[model samples]
Target: MFAGVDIGGTTTQVLLCTADLAVIDSTEVSTPAREGGQAMVRAALDALSVLRARVPSRLLGIGIGAAGVVDSRAGRILVASDSFRSWAGFEVTATVEKALGVPAFLDNDVNAFLRGEAAKGAVVDEPYVLGMTLGTGVGGALRLNGELLDGPHGAAGEVGHIPGFGDLPCTCGGRGHLETLASGRSIRARYGERTGRLLTARGVAEAAADGDPDALAVYEAAGAGVARAILITAGLLDITTVVVGGGVSRAWDLIQPPMLAELTAGPPVSGHPIRVVRARLGSGAVAIGAASRARTELDAVTRV
Candidate 1:
């Protein structure tokens, strides 16, 4: 058996899986975001302890999928969002391994999400993919030739931080980033700016469904921004297949039309129409992917 953990800003999810990555048991707990990394890890560990007690199989290893710029090679979180106090520069895998007496591996949450989709979800067997998640913030990862590229700086596929979308400020303190227009938080903020009514992204989607013109326009702009980001990625990486997931993507009915229209307006130079699809694994992608990572690494070690 292997364990997979996804440590997010608001929640921490843990899963017990078989060697092939089939989930046997799972649980979730609130992440102590402001309490520091030790508290957050304790939350995940506590849930993991509950899951471990229900299974009789010997645990082989553990894998963690965490939000931030992770240094997977070092088994540490190199940089994290401000929401997580004392998260950056923490030795995640070492701490988990010491507490649980097992080998542990760590990866960027978005990288794990992409790996999960490639292994068994939306982009299964696809050779090339660009995975994006549109939640409170936006994240991206690249999978090429069946392998994920972390790049020299571990920030290779950070598409959301790319500039030139508009003059809107980004959470990263940059001006005119894709996240300013395409993230769930951005969608809500954009709608509020137009209507003076603060609503959740879901509420804005409901308003759009009810024929609210302002809400409709806000979604359209978001869709257009996403389309532009996809085009730029397609142009540079020549990767046309994309998988998008997260909270905002639930409004696919509202976002897809404008996104498709924008894509059609400016096709990539290679003349291949970008194929964008929604993620199939839903919220469990990261955990499953982390399990898969552990399984792969353990198998490789055995062979070596």
Candidate 2:
């Protein structure tokens, strides 16, 4: 059996599936932030230990999907949560392997999402795909052929930090980044700027769906910003499909038109229309992708 853990700030979900990626057991627990990554890691291991004790099978290893700039090549965290201090560049995979005595694999959450989509969801039919997550910030990853493209520093496909649009503040302490203008927080904050209403991203989407012109305009701006990213990425990577996931994608009607418009206005493709598609696996994508990574790594280790 193998384990997959997606450790988010709100809730942590774990899955103990078969060797073939079929889920055999699962559990989720509220994350405890007081202890930071240490506590969260312990919680995940505890869950896996409980499962190992229950199941009558050999435990292979664990896979982790983290929500930060994870450096998978080094199995370390380059940058973690903004709300907490820092565990910058800490070798997480080695630590987890040492603690559990099982091989472990770590990956950025959006990278995992891309892997999941490529395997079973949006990009199942394609040989290459891009996955973008639009929640707290606009996160992205790319998969080529069947492999996740982790850059030399394991920071590939971070389109959120790309520049070209109007200047806006980003969580990474930079201005003019893509996420600053197109992310969920930025959308709601922008709406608050115009209407003086402190609404959530969901509320803003609801207002847009209700035909509020201001809300619609907000979505238009977001779409334009996101389209800038797509245009730049297409020119750089030449991928045919872009799969958008996360909470903001729920407002696809609001964001897609402008995103598509900007993308289409750019230099034409070679008769292949650029596709901005929705992620079908949704929340499960991250965990499933992480598990797939675990399986791959385990197989590699066995071969070695």
Candidate 3:
């Protein structure tokens, strides 16, 4: 058996699976992100303890998909959001391995998302695809020739931080980033600014479904931002397939029209016709991908 952990801003998930990738069980726990990386690791270990009690299987190793610019080779979080105070520079892999007395591997959550989709979910059998998640923040991953694109800076697929967007400030202390417009947080923020009412992104979607013009405009703007990002990705990489998921994408009905309209109007490039679709794995992609990563690491170590 192998274990996988997905550490998000609000919660962390633990999954147990067989060697062949069949999931046996899973658990969720609140992420102690504010207390720092060590606290967060303890929360994950607690979740793992619960899962172990349920399954009682011997785990081969553990893999983690975390929200940050992760240096997978060194198992370090190179950069992280303020939600996780003092998270950067933490040696996640070594810490987890030492705590559990088993090998541990770490990767950016978006990379794990793409790995799951490319290996078994949406875009399966397709070696080259773009993966985007529109949640609290916008995230992206690239799969080229059947491998996740982990750039030298461990930030290669971070399309959400790309500049040349509007002047809205981003959480990363940047201006004109795609995250300012395309993320679920941005959608809610834009709606609240226009209507003077604070609501969840889902509430904004419900209002859009009810044909509220202001809500519709917010979603349309989000769609347009996503379209712009997609076009930019296509222009640079010539990748035609984009698989989108996350909380915001649940409002596909409200976003697709404007997104398609913008895509239709964009200038023709090498990958002129882009195909944007939803992810098939739903909430389990990151865990499955993390498990796959653990298996890969185990195989590599065995070979060496």
Candidate 4:
């Protein structure tokens, strides 16, 4: 079997899988932020610490799906923010390979998530897809004609830093980016400051479900902001499927209607009907995708 590791802001997941991507074993663990990137790598290795007994031999090489800009070709984590302070400039694939004595394929977390979904989960076989995660911040990816649009610089689907937005600051050191308006932290901060409820984004969704007008309005604004970004993305890219993922997906009851309304309202330039929907696999998409990558390695190892 091959191993796939998906490292996120709050959690990390590892899985072993067959060549066709059927999961054989899996583990989930907390992300070590205070300990930073090196510690996080250790934790990832530990996640699979028990897999030796389940496999025939030393398992296949590992593939890491990490948060932020990952240079898949170079096996490096290229971007770091407050959420992933330890990952900036870390050559995670090399470190893990050296430490564990296995090859690894590294990629940005969102890219991995999309690849997972498209390969086996929600958007599989779809002609085009725009995967957006509304967790701590807004992370995005585009799959066009069944290929990931990672761009030459590995920053193609980064919709978080789009311009012409509001005054909210982004963790990426930019103002008016989509993350300031659409992320879970941004939603809670904006609503908490305005409504004085100090509720988390999940809590706000529950409140909205309970018919709290203020909380409902918070989600409405968030959906509207996301709509703006999605519309721009679709217009520029000609994509039609938007799979909304992350903590915000939990608030779909409050967010979906408004988000759809904005999409249907039509962009200034394009009037194509883009379908916006909830992510099918929820938070598991990353782990599932990582598992998918691991499955690829399993085939290679058996062949060798």
TM-score to native of every candidate shown: 0.98, 0.92, 0.97, 0.92
**Candidate 1, 219-262: lDDT as tens digits:** 99988988888888888888869999988999999989999999
Question: Residues 190-210, candidate 3, lDDT per residue (tens digit)?
Answer: 999999999899999999999
Best by TM-score: 1
Sort by lDDT, best first: what order? 1, 3, 2, 4
Can you give the lDDT of residue 237 in candidate 4? 84
Clashing pairs in 3: none
Give all candidate RMSDs, comma-separated. 1.0, 2.0, 1.3, 2.3
Point out the higher-scoring one by TM-score: 1 or 4: 1
lDDT of 4 by residue, 58-171 (tens): 566677888888787887877777766667888887888888787778878888788788887778788788889889888999899987888877888888778667887778
Q: Which ten residues in a row have the lowest lDDT in candidate 3?
A: 267-276
> lDDT for each of the candidates?
0.91, 0.82, 0.90, 0.80
Q: lDDT, candidate 3, residue 64?
A: 94
Lowest lDDT 10-residue stretch of candidate 1: 149-158
Quote model 2's TM-score: 0.92
Write the number of the candidate with greater lDDT, choosing between 2 and 4: 2
- Candidates 2 and 3 compared by TM-score, better number: 3
